[model samples]
Target: MTDFYDRAAAREAEILSDALAAQQRRARNGLGAVSALACEDCGASIPEARRQAIHGVQRCVGCQTVQERLAR
Candidate 1:
């Protein structure tokens, strides 16, 4: 019973450690980065709200819709 508890604690610690590392990496990736001002496909300006909401958005809604359709 003690061994099982120990193993569970160890696993929990490892999972928490991995979660922290992933969060740190994601924060690093986002640091000093801004979303695109214009859509790559249509050369239209992206809205400020959308740009702030998305990390590295490169397309407007219309162009993204078209691209997604093409992808499918």
Candidate 2:
């Protein structure tokens, strides 16, 4: 007999993988306007370390998290 549970687990894994790939793409290409160490929204200090770490990050971590939450 076929195992329904196994099928469900496979589907869940596929969905999770796709979501992760999409997130990676966003992280790679989302913040294109962040050429300086300042928040485009609040003018808060965006550290040099952060910019280097996140490719093209603009807003600080707090602002970025809030925006991502709202997006979901």
Candidate 2 wrongly placed segments (more than 4 Å)? 30-35
lDDT of 2 by residue, 1-72 (tens): 559998999999999999999998887685564555888778899988888777667688888888899999
lDDT of each: 0.90, 0.81
Estimated TM-score for each candidate: 0.53, 0.69
Best by TM-score: 2
lDDT of 1 at 10: 96
**Candidate 2: lDDT over CA atoms?**
0.81
The all-Cα superposition gives candidate 2 an RMSD in Å to the true structure of 2.7
Task: Write down the worst ten-residue block by lDDT for model 2.
Answer: 27-36
Please give the TM-score that candidate 2 achieves against the real structure. Answer: 0.69
